[model samples]
Target: MPLLDASRDLIAAAARRVMARCDELARVSAAQSGIERVYLSPEHARVNRLAAEWMREVGMTTRQDAAGNQLGRVGDPASAALMLGSHLDTVPDAGRYDGIVGVLMALEVVRLLRDATLPFAIEVVAFSDEEGTRFGKALLGSSAVAGAWDPGWWSLTDAEGTSLREAFLEFGLDPGRIGEAARQPDELVGYLEAHIEQGPELDERGESLAVVSSIASARRFQLIVEGEARHAGGTPYDRRRDALLGASEAALAVERICRAEHHIIGTVGQLEAYPGAVNVVPGEARLSLDLRGEFDGARDSVWSAISAELDAIMGRRGLRWTAREVHSAPAVFCAPLLQDAVREGIRSTVATTEDPAVIFSRAGHDGMAIGAVTGVGMLFLRNPDGISHHPDESVSEGDVARGIQSLAETVLQLAADR
Candidate 1:
């Protein structure tokens, strides 16, 4: 397939539109200072409405799915769709781009292809939840779309003690009908997402975009260490059984073990000691572990090594330890056909004779869930310094412009392949 006519001015104008829309959505935060829009919140509803309105302006029909995902589509309603988009949800104190840019870029792609003919329809989705900041579970929206929603998630509560079911009701949705959100494999040709690279790989290589090879396999756990509370002033080091000490040792062991393995990463993001009193030794300590790897066996093996180290630490500290598995997902690899499409799409925009860069995403994405039902592909725009999940995360307008063209071309490439 020949490339689309992506003139410099047209790309510049589209990039500005995408950037301005991003700024507008960033204001729909739950916080007063930084951006934060969680699932089933007022902000989510507002953004969905806004996205729907934009979709309508592009002559596409829109709907808010039972799972609260915002969707828009153009072309024949009966045809299988080429789905494009990313999450609309954000983490606490989030950057403007992470998921938002992808949604906007999807819209731009639809706009660019408005005059082109294709075999399948185009659908843009703004997934309601991917960060899982409120529900503590990622990919809820996409999982529902992939027919993988867990019934037990309804009981999961937020920090304010609002259950997921309750939040759904409050957001004007019926929990019983959530199954309506699932899309059969026959209904979709494939899924493609254009997102800001959450890491520095592209920026480090001085490239504008890259084709995503695969998303990492991940597991999360809540760990607890138990011990007897004692007086801080009178308890001797030999007599004290400190839960905090045991948990601390476990965290260090996680870092050491993960660092020794290739492409495995472990983080101890949350930690707390019970009784939180300066005058008393902690009776219990709780911490969270997020482990990810390029492969499932490697990720699981590292967890086993960490578990053995935790056993040794607890034994030495005279404490007891336990772990609760909260979440797990296997690695999702991109289809070779989609990967080639993405590569050619990216190569079309660059001036280089070399092939465009290819990368494996270490972070989680909705593709992890959608991959269950159909082929999945991703195009990543550069993120300076690899910063994300924070306010400082950034992408240049030029990169976004190229990303918009690249994604449009990718769709054409897919259409030609079909």
Candidate 2:
């Protein structure tokens, strides 16, 4: 019942190729040392070309969609297809395997199953953007596919003040044709994505992979606390209203409330004080609030309590406070049938009779956007340190090999039913 002893030669060979391709893709980055390929940039184009090349080698016809999503297909476009993919874009100073691994592993799955005529077509997708590095909004590529493109996104700009419409034109893509990316419900089967766990669950369980039960609903807010600024030496303790002190207490309240719950997580990831000086009492403070949970109702409930705590803190300190929501995404539960296939794949590939771990993903993904269209299923590869979105993100080759086999098996298991 050893987890890794069941590795096969064919799967290992395919995984070696997949990892080698990841190394090649990592070289196509905007950053010099670390990875930073964003949406519609030259690095993005280079990586797409590389992916198309690999797809062709596996008997897939390739093209980039209107929204710049790179795609490879094994059957006629007229036929319904099962989408398997992950984003190609990366955050600043990102690790190699966060999104790239899923795309590469999908190609390998196709390479393994190329000789067969499955019940449905298979499309390997390398989404153009997911990290939202250049554009402040995430899932630009997948959103287009899900037909969730907002007209307002065109007005969004990058750090350089270039509008999204301008960036699309610069990339030689027609923004007017973006609607061509949407896939209708009748046009395909469900989606399957193999990604790094981006957490410590699988590693902690000493397992190679796990099935995702649900993706967490998330909401973000910008909280601002305002008070009068005065000289630290001149302002009397009883007379002064320090915005920073109020913000500090609110952040602590968030942590305390979230920790008391089962799956809720609240983070004040960023904080800043105006006129940051040793002698000046802080007049204003701004903090980013990111909250997530397995259920939206529970998440919103916790947020309400946190808001009340912020209000109490502001009132006690004689400060005015305001909160504005920046983003919101509802929870998405995996289809029970797809979840079964994923579980079956894990058991067969790892040769383990032990029930595999099933966990909810607290981090958002392209699936959150894509789930608006079709059912979404995910397989999580073990990330030993539970680290992601950084240069240190990692997945062992052995685990990746297991991932390829499991993914291939998931497809085969579904095909058998079809």
Candidate 3:
């Protein structure tokens, strides 16, 4: 893609608009202080309406899909579309930019080329359930679009004990009609998403943007450790079998094993011990393990090592251990065509002599599901310190400005490719 004639001032103004819009959406959250917007909730409805209004402003037609994903399109509606945008749902206490920035930046891309003739139509989607904060199932919205929705998901309930089927009805949607949201493979030319880096790669490299090579393969498990409970005061150190202690050691083992490997990550996010009395040794303990890697083989290898270490720890403590797999997804690699488009897009906006940076995302995104139906590519903006999923997560206005231009350029590149 050739360098765009768009002036610095034009890009700056658009970036400011994106920032302001993010702040506006941040207020539409469930939490009293922090940000928390889940699927099929009132906040989801409000944000969808707001996105729809913005879509209309950009001369695009808008609608809410049967799966409750917000969508907008411009150009020839009868033709296949090159989809842009990302999820609108967020993790608990999520920062403002994680997914919200991508949706808004996509709108800006549309605004930049609303009048330009294209080979295909362009569509923006604000996926309703990417975080899985409510239903414990990620990519529900995108999975529906990919025609990969599982009937089993209907029975999944939220913390409030409301089933997904019930939530759909409450949100004025019919669960049976969700098939309407799925797009045939030919109906989409490709999907491109712009999002914050959600890591420190770009910021540390002093670059504003980079092309994502792939999203990490992931495996999540609930690990349980069991040991006999005994009187805390009466039991000797060698005689006591403490489940909590064994579970703690297992968590540390996960970190140790993963740390020794390249591009592997392990997190023990949640832990709980049974038998609440302080005087009593815990009889049972459970913990959540989130393991990710760039490749499935390496990821599985790390899991084996961690499991072996767990067995040794448990055996030494006279305990038993087991793990129940909760979720697993193979890595999704970006299509060569889309990746080239994004690479050229970033090159057009930068003055550096080096080629644009490329990274494999350790974090997951809607693309993981959308990739099943069509080619997918991503551009990531610099996130300061990569402090995501927290209130302090941040992105600079300057980076946002670069991101808008890069994305707009990427659309042009793809259009040229077609």
User: Highest lDDT: which candidate?
Assistant: 1
Candidate 1, 1-418: lDDT as tens digits: 3479657788789999999999999999999999999999999999999999999988889999999999999999899999999989999999999999999999989988898999999999999999999989999999999999999999999999999999999999999999999999999999999999988999999998999999999999999999989999999999999889889889999999999999999999999998899999999999999999999999999999999999898988889999999999999999888999999898877778898988999999999999999999999999999999999999999999999999999999999888
Q: State every prediction's TM-score relative to the real structure.
A: 0.99, 0.96, 0.98
How well does model 1 score by local distance difference test? Answer: 0.94
Winner on lDDT between 1 and 2 is 1
Model 3: lowest-lDDT 10 consecutive positions: 1-10
Q: Could you give me the TM-score of model 2 versus the true structure?
A: 0.96
Cα-based lDDT for every prediction? 0.94, 0.90, 0.93
Estimate the lDDT of model 2: 0.90
lDDT of 3 by residue, 61-151 (tens): 9999999999999988689999999988999988999999999999998988876888999999999999899998888999999999999
Rank the models by TM-score, top first. Answer: 1, 3, 2
lDDT of 3 at 330: 92
Is 2 or 3 the stronger prediction by lDDT? 3
User: 174 in model 1: Cα distance from truth in Å?
Assistant: 1.0
Q: Model 2 off-target regions past 4 Å? A: 1-7
Q: Is candidate 2 or candidate 3 better by TM-score?
A: 3
Error of 3 at 69 (Å): 0.5
User: For model 2, where is the 10-residue window of minimal lDDT?
Assistant: 1-10
List of clashing residue pairs for candidate 1: none
